[model samples]
Target: MSPDLSLIFVLGLRMAVAAAFVVSASIIAERSGPVIGALVATLPISAGPSYVFLALDHDAAFIAEGALASLPVNAATLFLALTYVLLAQRHGLLLSLVSALAVWFLLAAGLRALDLSLVGGLIANVVAFAICVPLMQRYGHVKMPLITRRWYDIPFRASLVAVLVAAVVTLSGRVGPAITGILALFPVVFTSLMLILHPRIGGPATAAVIANGGWGLMGFGVAIAVLHVAALRFGSAVGLSLALATCVGWNLALWWNGRRKVAVAK
Candidate 1:
């Protein structure tokens, strides 16, 4: 796709939406409770920039490179953000800005030495880290009141689901852009559900389903996006649509569940 004004406009809009979601989630978290908000914020914080990159480019190599390059910065930002939040009690705006710039400088130097294009990498690095700081502080930590046992299993469970989806898609010979797109939905759905349900899976159930599910979903989404794009297919649009659906579905389910529980308790 040519870099045109319309494309730039769309990219801007996507960034805006992502920014808005992150901010809203963070605010909601700060209001509801600090720990929960921090944990909740991680979703948009970590995934938002990557999502933007995927939306902008359908190239597998490019996506992989971008993801790989961005991971360190993302991790650093999350850790720092969490630290700042714990220490500051409120959002650490100045610290976040400085940390972001520091990360960008380090990433830029590394990219330069490796002879990689810094254009997209710089943007991704800056934006991803900048957003992750507040998010980590607001909703990065997992504190599941209702699902305490399964709280720790969220990431693992999501990853497993994502892997299973990728495996099935691969074996079915239906691993095209469309199929990959469908597969990408699994993570989005899985994460959304986990965030909403925050269920408690005690005993072995915790290890088997809960942990694997979280990692599975994330892994599957990233894997399929990479593989599909590598095959020269553009599945991002479909994948994005599925992600939106997952988010919507998750919120609805949560609302319904909350109401039902309240009614039962009363």
Candidate 2:
């Protein structure tokens, strides 16, 4: 295939993969409970594919640095979730989303200016997520309301994910690898899910989902930190594989831990 054809093919593939995950997660959120839905949404479904393409386009070192960049940005994502939850209580959905996105931009800018190392980035993410989760938890644990599925829901979510993926990835290339990595975690899936749920279920229900998603992001943070270090020592593929394994393991541990806590409560 020609280079142009290959680029188009790759872009299509990326969009398709991202869209599938977003749609599937939203569906699961509709069918299952918030915790399960949040778990699936937090799995780096969007970011993972972008990172893979980053590796393919750039070198292992670039991807490694990008992975490090991704860690602190997880905090920005947490902030977005928190802001949305807080604002959604009093404001309309669109206004709340706008306010939250504004906060995200401000926070991301401030964070990018700090020039943190991998360890510092990891610490920042840990602190941010820790603070965000419990604060948002009050909005969680509500009973999920039963809502009829809209016929256009899946298509709309897929389209949103596709657009977000395309825009983020395209801009990442222009911005350089470090910023690219950070931009890669733009909360596409979380935003889509919340937007859909906020109107259908209510602000509180959507907030619950977003809060759990923020908690789940802790595992994602660990995975990216590991990938940054590992990719430098190992190759891209190996590092990514290990990182994914770590993410899955951490998420499973969180699930089991949550279950144990619930059992104790019972």
- Candidate 2 lDDT at 139 equals 80
**Candidate 1 lDDT by residue in tens digits, 193-229:** 2233323322222112222122222322333333333
RMSD of each: 15.5, 1.7
The most accurate candidate by lDDT is 2
lDDT of 2 at 174: 84
TM-score of 1: 0.37
Candidate 2 residue-wise lDDT at 31: 72
The true-versus-predicted C-alpha distance at residue 155 of model 2, in Å, is 1.8
> lDDT tens string, model 2, 105-217?
88888888887898899889888977898888888776789988888888888888788778766776688887888678888888888778888888887877787777688
Top-scoring candidate (TM-score): 2
Q: Estimate each model's TM-score.
A: 0.37, 0.93
lDDT of 2 at 155: 87
